[model samples]
Target: MVPEAEFTSYYGRPIVKPSPWEADIPAYLFAGGLAAGSSLIAAGADVTGRPVLRRAGRLAALGALSISMAALVHDLGKPSRFTNMLRTAKPTSPMSVGTWILSMYGPFAGLAAAAEVTSLLPEQVRSRGPLRLVGLLGRPAGLVAAVCAPPVAAYTAVLLSDTATPSWHSAYKELPFVFVGSASAAAAGVGMIAAPTHETGPVRRMAAAGALLELAMEQRMERSMGVTAEPLHHGKAGRLMRAAKVLTAAGAAGTLVAGRSRALAAASGAALVLGSACTRFGVFEAGQESAKDPKYTVVPQRERLEREGPVRYQP
Candidate 1:
């Protein structure tokens, strides 16, 4: 019997197109997730009467949101054109839904942070009618931000998965949860760094939970991709993912022992933040690599055809 013929491509070019989004888009995704998770944690802190945690969370959410916005605009390349994105509301479009979510959440996140900062003013200043009004509005604004946070954090995964990108689309079922874990870890890291030691119990627990979820989901995601996962473990992307795992493990361990030590908390928090960033960049880079290699796209389709057989089209 003759052996199966080897695969070939036209002039060595990729059969599947790479994503048009550049590095800025992934950076925005990381920052936006951090903002959403932090907003949720801040609201929880407020509800639980953790003043220090509430303040830290609010500030972290605001700062990350700001950075995320900037990254998105930079990716757009034309700042003035950004407003055009909001002109239309299309339910079927993930980008449109995301734009609307950001529009709704950004103001609340900003106002909530502003209100917190305002509350820190002198008693005499806070007693002013305008300031008092702002203080009264802060709680509701924060609550609104919290309500919108989950969608903001999760929708980016949908956006990536909706694309024709092989690695991302293939891992759709697991990517959202992976992002959730990273987001939770990042937000918890911020709280650990900024909240008082005694007030960080919730943050520590969150860090642990997020780290575990991220690690587990990431492993399953890679394994489920089969040969398509090769790009994830081979080169620059692999190094980043490996480093992320190490940092995540170390940070999780440190959280266990940090207790009331500010130094240890800072170290652990930094590691978590870096690990989350590495995960985002690594995933983005892996998708690009997978697109560049035709085998990732063609082989998977071939396997599906072999297993299920070609569909019969109606005459």
Candidate 2:
């Protein structure tokens, strides 16, 4: 019997060009998610009367957003290139939508964080009219940031999955869930680290919920992706993903017992943040790797064609 012909593309070159993005893109993704999640946590803390948690979350939101914007600008190679994206909004374009989201989110997050800073000023300065005004505006600004948070956390997944990259495109259905969950875990970690143990009940619950959701979504995505998922399971991507899973799981479990000890809470929180970062980087690497291998492209197309048959054109 004749052996099946091996799938090859022009001396084994990649069938699709990998995205030119480097580490900056993944960093952007993680920071953006963290910013979004932190904003949400800040809002929650505000409502629950947890001053420390609220302050930390607001500061983190602005700081993370700044990092995210910096990374995106660096990846674009010019600040002007990013601004150009704002000239016209394209509803159909993920990049355009995401840019707009960032624009809206940045001002609110900044205002919220500025308010927090004003509150930290010396009593005399904070009691002054200008600082007092800023402090008064903080809650509303933080609320607005919370309102904008979900899209910020989830848009990067849509942006990544909108591309032709096999792993990213194939896993589009689950990527958003994974991203949002990771964001939640990271934000909860920040709250846990900064808030008093008595005020961390909600944060611990968020950590456990987010970790579980992220882990579940990742598994489901990989299982559904078939051959395209191979990149996520091997190489540097695999190692990072494994680390993420371990850290996230351990952090979630730790939350259950970390209530009594500030040190344990801080360690658990750090693990969750690191795990979230690893998850983003792992996903980024997997997409890049899938784009580099011809088989990831060919096998999926072949399987689809076999299932759907050839397209017929009408004269």
Clashes of each: 0, 0
Regions more than 4 Å wrong, model 1: 1-7
lDDT of 2 at 115: 96
Q: Cα deviation in Å at residue 87, candidate 1? A: 2.5
Q: How do the residues 214-286 of candidate 2 rate in per-residue lDDT, one tens digit apiece?
A: 9999999999999999998899999999999999999999898997799999899999999999999999999
Whole-model Cα lDDT per candidate? 0.90, 0.95
Clashing pairs in 1: none
lDDT of each residue in 100-201, candidate 1, tens digit only? 999999999988898899889999998799888888888899999999999999889888887878888888999999999999998999889888888889
How does model 1 score by TM-score? 0.95
Residue 123 in model 2: lDDT = 92
Q: Find the number of clashing residue pairs for candidate 2.
A: 0
lDDT of 2 at 21: 96
